[model samples]
Target: MQRMGGASASLVLFLLSFSAPAAPIPAGFVSWDVTFPGNSGSFDITNQTGPNASTFPDTTFPITTTLHLSGLGLTVHFANGSTVVEPSSYFTLSADGESFNGSPIAIGGTNPLPTSATLTGTFSPVFITLNNGTTQTILSSFSATISPSAGTTLADGDFAIINATTTTVTGTPEPGTWFLTVAGFGTLLGWRKKGLATFRNLLERKGAL
Candidate 1:
């Protein structure tokens, strides 16, 4: 019994050592950078300071179609009066297997984040490409490096946001169908109970449980 207890205590200690702290809320966009294979095209992102649309300008990102983005790499820069941050990666988007990515803040806000700290998302849109080796496209998820831009001077009412998905499909279910179905179910139960009660009463007159 002594050996077993000692072994159990040792195992518990080992588990505690390997456990990690909870991840923090992806807070401000102090800085970041994302790089990706060339050929990624222009992608747009939304930026607003508060809940309104006038805080920052809506902008489209630059692209590098070469195998590698060289010295002129993309970046997002952020700074409060006393602090600054930037991204080293790009945010990405895709459809039917094709992709596009960006390395700057997708959306910007003015007040939610301090100039010293801002949130940023970089992306790389993924798509299949053929360079004479084959004649087809197989959309696959590809990494798009993203981060903050170089020389960013964030303002008090400036921020960034990423619209996670752009795909919109619309269809309506049989409108009122579910509500009617639920009502039908209650009707069914009520009728079933009434029939059972009637049968029970008749049985009691004759003889049944």
Candidate 2:
């Protein structure tokens, strides 16, 4: 009976280990939450920027580059009331992290909109470093679009004067993590089956089954 109790306790501990929560975010990281028409998410960025400020050609506006980010949790809410937790993807900053310039992961799809129309693109080569020191590609590609309302204007031929009402972004996780997750579940199942069998045999021998 004592041995069976010990085995049951060990099995419970192993199951709890698999169901443990994620690690907490480190200190000194700034948290941000953004919500648009189609999706909402939260992320944490390093509080400081790079040492040197970058500037555009023929302009003197100093652009401070953000250092790094982690804990990027995103969710995509579809029109049919379905929601998907988007994988953590690498985000780039242009113009103080508020704008994008021709990159595939552009927040607004494009920097300077010559005309008001819907633009579509994808986010490629997106990856994030996990807390375990493993670099994983949480998101592979995305389909996004941006449409400007009527009477939108450009300021000094540099910035766009428009409101981003709705934007759609989507992505999928890489296969490596998925495989490991499946394998872990399989191992847990095997352990559970073996433990139950042993417990049953002991109970039968002791006339308790």
Candidate 3:
């Protein structure tokens, strides 16, 4: 009877700390690079923690994502020491994207991984919507451990979105933003070459490339 009780308690704990793929990002942070015709920059997504923020089951070293929402929140930074905190209606969403490459596995090919592995990507639905009505985006260092239980589809990679914030980043970006933009673009193109995919939504629109 004691063993059964302990088992029940474990299961209950799992249920209480539940987290789902693309469920909704907890109110936290997000950072992304912004690029124009030839110029590029980056900005951070900041917000207030909600009432249940403390209870949100956050996976240690988890991956982050953005949704590129259509309205009510938008911001941008540029290379010429300028920032664009457009009105809420100025935000736009684009469904054009694909998955990134899964982390490199050993060449020898173990049928199943004996231990956990860490992986991250910029194009997967790693972000979640917070109950506080604000979006939670992640920083560049987001990550996760890969185990058999995660799923095969996820074996490919993750997703990302473009977000504009209420605040503005006024500055000439450091070389980091340019480098990150290059990396982001390269990854997106590689996913295309891999025949990953791009979704289309008339509502979100796709003006920026």
TM-score of each: 0.18, 0.24, 0.21
lDDT of each: 0.30, 0.33, 0.32
Residue 145, candidate 1: C-alpha displacement in angstroms: 58
Q: Which residue pairs in candidate 2 collide?
A: none
Question: What is candidate 2's lDDT per residue for 1-209, written digit by digit as tens?
Answer: 56445555655554443443332221122222232312322232323222322233411212232223333333433333444454444344435443222212112333232221122122222333323333323233222222223344211122211111112112233464455456556666766788889889999999996
Tell me, by lDDT, which candidate is best. 2
Highest TM-score, which number? 2
Candidate 1 on 21-138: residue-level lDDT in tens? Answer: 2211111122222122121222222321122222113322211111111112233232433323333334343231222244434223441222223333332232211221211111
How far residue 164's Cα lies from its native spot in candidate 3, in Å, is: 16
- TM-score ranking from best candidate downward: 2, 3, 1
Tell me which of candidates 1 and 3 scores higher on lDDT: 3
Q: Is candidate 1 or candidate 2 better by TM-score?
A: 2
TM value for model 3 = 0.21
Clashes of each: 75, 0, 16
